[model samples]
Target: MPYPSSDTPAANPSPADSRAARLWEALPGLSYGADYNPEQWPEDIRRQDVELMKEAGVTVLSVGIFSWAWLEPSEGRYDFAWLDGVLDSLADAGIKVALATATAAPPAWLVLKHPEILPVAADGTTLGPGSRRHYSPSSSVYRRYAARMTRALADRYGDHPALALWHVDNELGCHISEYYGPEDAEAFRGWLRRRYGSIEALNDAWGTAFWSQRYGGFAEVQPPAPAPTTLNPTQQLDFQRFSSWALIDFYNMLAAVIHEVTPDVPTTTNLMASSATKSMDYFSWAKDLDVIANDHYLVAADTERHIELAFSADLTRGIADGKPWMLMEHSTSAVNWQPRNLPKLPGEMARNSLAHVARGSDAVMFFQWRQSRQGSEKFHSAMVPHDGTATRVWREVVELGAALKALAQVQGSRVESRTAIIFDYEAWWASELDSHPSQDVKYLTLLRAFHRELFLRGITADLVQPGADLSGYSLILVCTLYTVTDAAAANIAAAAERGATVLVSYFSGIVDQHDAVRLGGYPGAFRELLGINSEEFHPLPQHGTVGLDNGWKGRIWSENVRLAGAEAVVSFTGHPLAGVPALTRRVVGSGAAWYLATFPDDTSLAGLLDSLLAESGVAAPATAPAGVELTRRLGAGGASFLFVINHTGAEADVAASGRELVTGTQFSGVVQPGAVAVIVEDAPGGQPG
Candidate 1:
């Protein structure tokens, strides 16, 4: 039987897209859960866990994600007795299951039997069998064993009463992400052969002649390992691409087995930190998931972290194309891994969870339910903290659970944004190559800065891929897009032609997919769309600063920008290229294009964006102070909601006239400090009185 995961394969607007659709269609109302590890506790403790889960309003439990060792202690000797009892008990308590395939951590027996399956570091050190995810992604032997385990689990629990979703491996590229053994070398060679048909083509694309590092055959090429000197940029780029695909291929193999055995279950794996992770391209991986899921942890040390969290949530929602997703893992309080684990202040935990929902997450979940008594994550906070239900974390968890239950009306809703920020993994990979102009040119840092500007102004931006449907957005920002593919360039140009405001910042449109420059000039692919020409990249010294004619500072990067058919918008104040146009704008048909030749400071970037937004006739969500984030989600039949989040210590007024969903009071007042309020409006895009 064919499962109805999705009826259509278009890029967006699938009938069965959001997690809310699949989960709510099976079970009504919102989802609240955590990663359950019952095997860690005794049967008596597990009985207590069930009662607490009911009290906490947890409808779903992500079970068996790391239970492979317990399920099959010895090869071929199955033991589902304990799991069966756990599932049955949970079902009796009315809790559904997001059934994990349990392939994330293989048992010691398998790794000990085939040590060759262990991942080898780039330094030629083979990782030992002590930790989890030690298996090599490129090892065929590992795949064979993983597939066997997957088939067995799916066959046994295909029609289980508690099964709701299928989770494939935990955090695909956490550890063992990059492999450099003979197996990986062989795999890399094959990947290269597929990407570039002939050795001559490969050499030409890699520009191997620069360092006398030409390869005559594909077999001679090696996985870019720790070299005695600087490694080849193209080789490193391909290896990153190959490693990402290797993990994806592993997921596909497991998903095939689950589909064959339990076709009705939708498959997904948790994606972690899209801006931080380098190996996996989530935009590509999102297609495989019937419902996209992500694990987000805030930089609690930063005072403005809520803004970053909102950015991550918006990016994840954009990857799902406005579909509601799952917040698979987050901390109830302080996480243990950071340098300093600062517990969330009063009301901050609920604010963090609801921020995700306010953006577009349907399910609010965490890494673990109960805090561990022993392990590397013993200090990590949980739904039930170490102090039991009497603690502040517990009270907040219970409060968030009640809030989610009351949010049943908001289920299946989509958050819509007229602004988009283009984020490409390939561009991030290429821009950070070894021999770049400045080591300070971090891609995510700059992108996040631009995103924070829009966010501070109470505007939500979709973190879109280059090929995403730009027709839906009015303002598009492509910041530091150093690597430009032909298709990606055309997509932006087409968007500009269709009357969208386009902004291409410094260091953009410089290289192609092969890590090679687009020969004639800088920003070769996007010069025409931007209506400006650049000759070279002029990187500033470390901690260097320059002045912009608009009274804002420019720092870290500057380019020699000259006008072709566009008019100058901002010029350098005192530099060798003074009055040579720091920024330019061009009117293309009904749309307009603007180019910034240097990385502007935050104040400058904000002013530039303000001008652009005004010129494009786009309005912010209503005038509010900084640290107050705003977003709007729409339900079927004209139901609209306004979400106001105040991330600061000072109270701020949220201008709205409607019924507040969480408190059931009439809206329009000063939102409390470190608080969140959801108001249901009478019409979409309704302004405050």
Candidate 2:
């Protein structure tokens, strides 16, 4: 079949399709609040909770994330004691509900009573009690009870006035483990059967005979584990594929439970941005979801440099296949997990959220509504506080909420993008897991180097997946794609061949989905797509820096790249690898592809990326002087907005092409410390937002 399938667009979905769509229609006037645990609160406090939310303009509340203990008080007995009251109070407060599936954890009583619910890690170690998300996805007992609980919630609250959305199993990878026990092995056999149909076809595709992975029928197959590297790349790739599919199956079963009860309500699970390691194939769950939401967390605060966020949003977008999105979980303030939990100084939260909207976001809610007392996230910041309000974070949240309300019309609008970046977890995993060269060169890092530049320069970048159409985009970057199906590779090549500028990173196109190395040199399979053959590689240590051999040189890790249907635009200097191609560009069809062999500093990367954006006609924030930052988002009804923020401790010069929304002034230069400029326009070059 042709790539991306040119899918038949759905007929206007029925009202019975989901109440979730009703909520989307109501999105502009809505407000998003975070995890509310009325299960742990008293009636009076719960009442106060409603008032507090209303004060902050919170129109929707995600209830029951950790309410399994309250709901399933016993194995077969169910109690709606606290939950019923919570809903009644929410109804009184005029709050809509995105009811959680409440299956993230089974109560301790259930876990001890039924040890079968306990999960085993890939290494055969059993996860114990005391923490949530430790339950096994494939454990039959767990699924049965989880389904029962979902059905109960649906049957009871499906028609509730407060019902708006369905949140399934909060933060799906919080447990940090994947199952590979005998249970997984059993499921893998079944999954393999469905994927390849027959053992002969599977063997033919995997070339199993060479690796002794040959199976007579299906009984011989087992789930992939962290085992002998000597195993054939095909088996290894299959194991990874199996692992990804297993998680999807696990989620599917949970979702089935939700559908069984509340078929009219949309269901979705929140995935994290940095979890390529788990092989969560969200593509498999796209249509199954009412909305694709993700927790945007990164170790570094380089909002522009973190292409992972764009990748997350893009992948999330495609999962729903161009449907609007939700930033279901993100930090409105400093995150405790990073090495430096720097608070989002001033307008950063507003800026980052707008960036999501610029690409395509329906709402920008955070992970936490209130700070925790004690736990792994004890220090995580929240929009509200344990101290009963009056905190900087809470104050900022209030202000940000007001801003969102002001721009309500922009909420569900998607950017009609001309640029895209394909984010493949499979390719990321394959590049990282390879036995060859080096693990230091992370595929994601390579991708971010290009994306960060576009982000800071105020260019909209869409993150997409393999086989997605590139006709809508003028530029597409595919980084470190070590392994992919021929179908996917073909789509990318087709896009580049059709006048889209492509950036092909090192170590890409080296193998297939089965981990089989392509004939010829590196990026062997995509040589034609990229139009190059790497003759030699000049690998460098992390500290070994190089300057471009050109008149301009800077400190960066560089390598020599050979050119074919491309030009040696940049090369390394000062080291033995100096005077060789570090960067090359090739015109494919009517467009082009630029290849980078090794990692480089952000500064150098910015130059290359910015130059590309300029060539593509995407404009940067006009007057964002030093210490002042800018961004823009495409909104509904042909409206767009540019965000100009001051990041300096002192006042700085700001640029603007139109009137600012915050102050309604045509900004030129000189913005005060921590000040902001929100420009609203009509289209690409419309008014200031």
User: Which candidate number maximizes lDDT?
Assistant: 1
Positional deviation of residue 660's Cα in model 2 after best superposition, in angstroms: 3.8
Give one digit per residue, the lDDT tens place, for model 2 in 1-689. Answer: 11122123336865433445666765544356676777655678777778888888787778898888888877768898678888888888877778898988788887887786787777778888788887777778777888778888888888888888888877765655457656767777887889889999888777887756788988977656567665556666666666666655667787777677766667777866443434666665565666777777644556442345555665566565666677777887778877788777666676666556545567777867777777777677777766657777777778777776765655544555566777777777677665656657676776765665665555556667778767777778887778878999888888877877888777788778767778777667777766668655555665666677654443323444556677888876775776677778887778777877666566667677776776566566465555455555555444556655665678765544555555656656566776665666533444433
Task: Give the distance in Å from residue 526's predicted Cα in candidate 1 to where it truly belongs.
Answer: 1.3
lDDT of each: 0.83, 0.69
How well does each candidate superpose onto the true structure, as a TM-score?
A: 0.96, 0.88
Which residue ranges in model 2 land beyond 4 Å of their true spot?
A: 1-20, 204-213, 226-231, 275-278, 298-322, 332-359, 374-378, 535-538, 545-548, 551-567, 570-582, 601-603, 626-629, 650-659, 662-672, 682-689
User: Whole-model lDDT, candidate 1?
Assistant: 0.83
* Predictions: Cα RMSD each: 3.2, 4.1
- Kindly report which residue pairs in candidate 1 clash with one another: 509-523
